[model samples]
Target: MKKLFTSYLDTFKGLSKEIWWLALITLVNRAGAMVIPFLSLYLRDDLGFSLSSVGWVMTCFGFGSLFGSWLGGILSDKLGYYKTILLSLIATGIGFLGLQFITSFWAVCLGFFALITVADMSRPAFFVALSAYSKPENKTRSLTLIRLAINLGFSAGPALGGIIIASIGYYGLFLADGITCILAGFLLIQTLNPKKAKEVDQEQLVENPLAPHKDGLYVIFLIALALFGVVFVQYFSTVPVYYKEVRLLTESQIGLLLGMNGLMIFVFEMPLIAYMERRGWNLIGNVIGGLLLTGLSFLFFYIEGWPGVLVLGMATATLGEMVAFPFGNAFALRRAKLGRQGAYMGLYSMSFSLAHIFGHNSGMQLVNSLGYNLTWAIMGLITLLALALLFYVKRRANTLKI
Candidate 1:
């Protein structure tokens, strides 16, 4: 264990100050990630929306993201990551503010799409900024650190959000979430001055313009990863409704359960990644193992009567996330062509958002028609197919003479 600790230390050896600040920014922004976790609940319990309506609203968020992710990449490449991040954050906060007033089905759905589109547009740009701020050897570790911060913040978001809802009500939740997002944006403005950020962007690779759409193998990889995302998103879309409606868990109890995922990732992700790297484990193998575990974790939901079993399942899924996400990010970063960092990463981010669209829509429909158990079972099966395809793609990815 001590040796593993040392390996974890090794991963952070040469990170720049900028990288640390970026992580801080991520933590601050994600800590306010209170809205999405309880969105289905809010719509269902508060506004009396059906599960199908909740799913459709969530899908709108994803659809907006599809556009936002691509546009964010372009802006990051043009305006620099600093500006793109700043603007997206502020816009997203405004979007949430809009959500505070709108309750009609079309109004809420449209607001959410606009909000997601603006907010998510920063993702690719943020990826580019993160990559630029780290040493080449520390790429995966850097991404993991950023993810660690995200989860750490997420750990707090749901629990705190639950308390907020109990104390101040649902609109208060929207207000608080909006404020923090905009705060993160302004913080970027204060820290990443134009002169400093411009110099940094000048040193980075130029845009590849056509790489994301044109690269055949990378496109195949995106499709596969997106499929995996379709399965992954059910954690937010369908799982909470299941817990509340089927298992009769309270909001606080539900918060604890979801928070468990973030907490596990916060505490264990880096060390696990460090251990795997030191052991000289193959990344493709790690990804495949993660994917299988993800499938099995969802499959564990088949154990209907035991809450402990569900906890175990969430724990297992976090382990899968730790394995797959960093390696996949590192893989994408490595694949970016000269000058196309923003475009490629944006495309990658877009693929995941696209998955949210499919996942929410389909998962909700399955819930209505097939019952909860079969819904989860089908999701697990989808992951199995994705896992197989990902393995084949990993082999192909390895052979590509990039």
Candidate 2:
């Protein structure tokens, strides 16, 4: 037991203090990320919006994310990651604080679009910062550490968010979200000078970094990523509705269940990643396996009538997430040459943004028309398609020496 504990602890070693600081900032920001998980419920129950209406609003949210990601990439390259991140954090905080004032449907749609656009601008900049702060060899573990912080914060956020929502309503949730983001921004400004971080080795930099749009294989990889995101994001967008309506769970109960995903990742993911990294396993192959597990998670929903099946499905999906996301991020980062890291990471973030645009609205529309079982089935089929595309990417990457 002692040896086992030490081994688990060992996985966390060798990361720089800057990485830890970055992780801390992420933790603070994500811990207040209570709004999005409950956005659909708030729209439906509080504002009396229909499921389809909620879907449209969320689609607008996706469009905002798409634009923000592109802009962030450009800013990260032009202004540097530090300024880009700091600006995004402060702007996103102010946006969230003001968002609660817009109540009408169209106004709400516009509000969400504007808020998410500013908020997601942080994504690519954050990735570029991660690269700047960590050693080349430790990059994957560094990403895993940041992900752990995010999951840890997410695990706590939802549970507390449920309590906050129950006691003070959605306004309190928004207040918390805004305050935390601002606090994180201040924290970033106070600690960690970006100037002192490790510089990209000139010799290692690609002389001609391929533009992401022009890279066919990378585009294929992005499509697969977007599809995987479409399947995965259903947990956030539609699964809560399924929990409330079908399982008849309360807001608190739903929060706990959702929080379980982060808890599971926090407990297991780092160790698993360490083992995988040590083995030098193929990143794409691992992603393929993760996608398969994610697909099977949805298949469990087909059984129905038993709420435990929901738990099982969530577990399977979380395991798949743990396996796939960090490695996928590392793979993307590795593919980016130093000069154009911002563009590559931006497109990488955009794939998920694209997923957000189509995933939520489509899932909700399908559920409204076909019900949960069929929706899950369709998501599984989508995963299969994503997996097939990934196989092609793997082959092409080998052939192209990418």
Candidate 3:
């Protein structure tokens, strides 16, 4: 245990202050995501929203993010990463506070939209900062650490939210979450300021580095990644509804399940990425496998009555996420051409937004019309298609030498 602890510390030793600061920002921002883990329940139970209504609310949030991501990237390039990040944090914090005052469905939806927009806007800036910070050799590990921190925050956030929501309810959760965002923004303000790194010898060897690629590769990757976003969006939209409406789980139980996924991510993601890197597996293969694992895990919903099955499913899917996401990010960052890091990251962020808009709206419709079981089953099938797409993408990347 001590050895492992020391090794983990060693990983951070040479990491840039920018990576640490951004990651710390991620930690604080994600802590507020606890409110989101059970947002469907809050909408349905506390706000008296229907599934369709919840879908629209999520759609608004997604729509906001679509623009937010692009704007963040553009602004990062023009206004600087530090300014963009700080502005986004302020917007997101204000939005979270607005959530406390929502009484009607429209108000809630709008508030969510505003909050997600700001949070998402912060993403491109942070991504650009991270890419600018690390050496190619340590890049993957650095991202893994960032992810671990985010997951660690995620694990604790929902657990804390669960306890708070169970006792004081959603109002308290929203207020506390907002305050946390404010604190994060303040910390980031103190620590991070972007200063460009001079090109090193190793940077020259890497072809078409984040210098800005015009080959349209970024667009293609963005499209494929949006499909991934579609699959992931189910976590907030369909999964919560399923746990509640179909399986009859309580809020606390749902929180536990969501937190369990984060726990697995925190525990296993970095080591797994390291192991795969050691084996010389292509980054694309890890992404494909991750998508497959995530898709297949949905099959466990067939055993939802057992409760533990859901826990096991989270663990399985989380393992896939651990493997796929970090590698995919590293690959994408490395492939981005010079000076286009913000644009590429913005496109990447947009994929998640597109997915949320498409996935939630469609999943909610399917659930209302077809039923939760069938909806999940169909979603699994869609994920398989995404995996197949990843396969094609991998082959294409190899051919293009991207």
Cα lDDT tens digits for candidate 1, 61-157: 8999999998998998888888899889998888787788899999988988998999888999889888877777677888889998899888899
Query: Could you tell me how far off, in angstroms, the CA of residue 402 lies in candidate 1 after the best superposition?
Result: 5.0
Clashes of 3: 8
- Candidate 3's TM-score reads 0.92
lDDT of 2 by residue, 1-402 (tens): 999999999999988888899999999999999998889999998889999999999999999999999999999999998999999999999999999888999999999999999899999999988987788888899999999999999999989989999999989888999999999999998875565555442336678778888877778989999999999999998999998998899999999999999999999999999999999888898898888898899887678677798889899999999999998998898888634999999999999999999999999999999999899889989998999999998888778766
Per-model CA lDDT versus the true structure = 0.84, 0.91, 0.78
Off by over 4 Å in 2: 195-203
Residue 266's lDDT within candidate 3 is 78
Clashing pairs in 2: none
Count of backbone collisions in candidate 1: 3
97 Cα displacement, candidate 1 (Å): 2.0
Q: With candidate 3 superimposed using the best TM-score fit, by how many Å does residue 349's alpha carbon deviate from the native?
A: 0.7
Error of 3 at 86 (Å): 0.8
**TM-scores for every candidate against the unseen true structure:** 0.94, 0.97, 0.92
For lDDT, candidate 2 versus 3, the one ahead is 2
CA displacement after TM-score superposition, residue 329 of candidate 3 (Å): 0.8
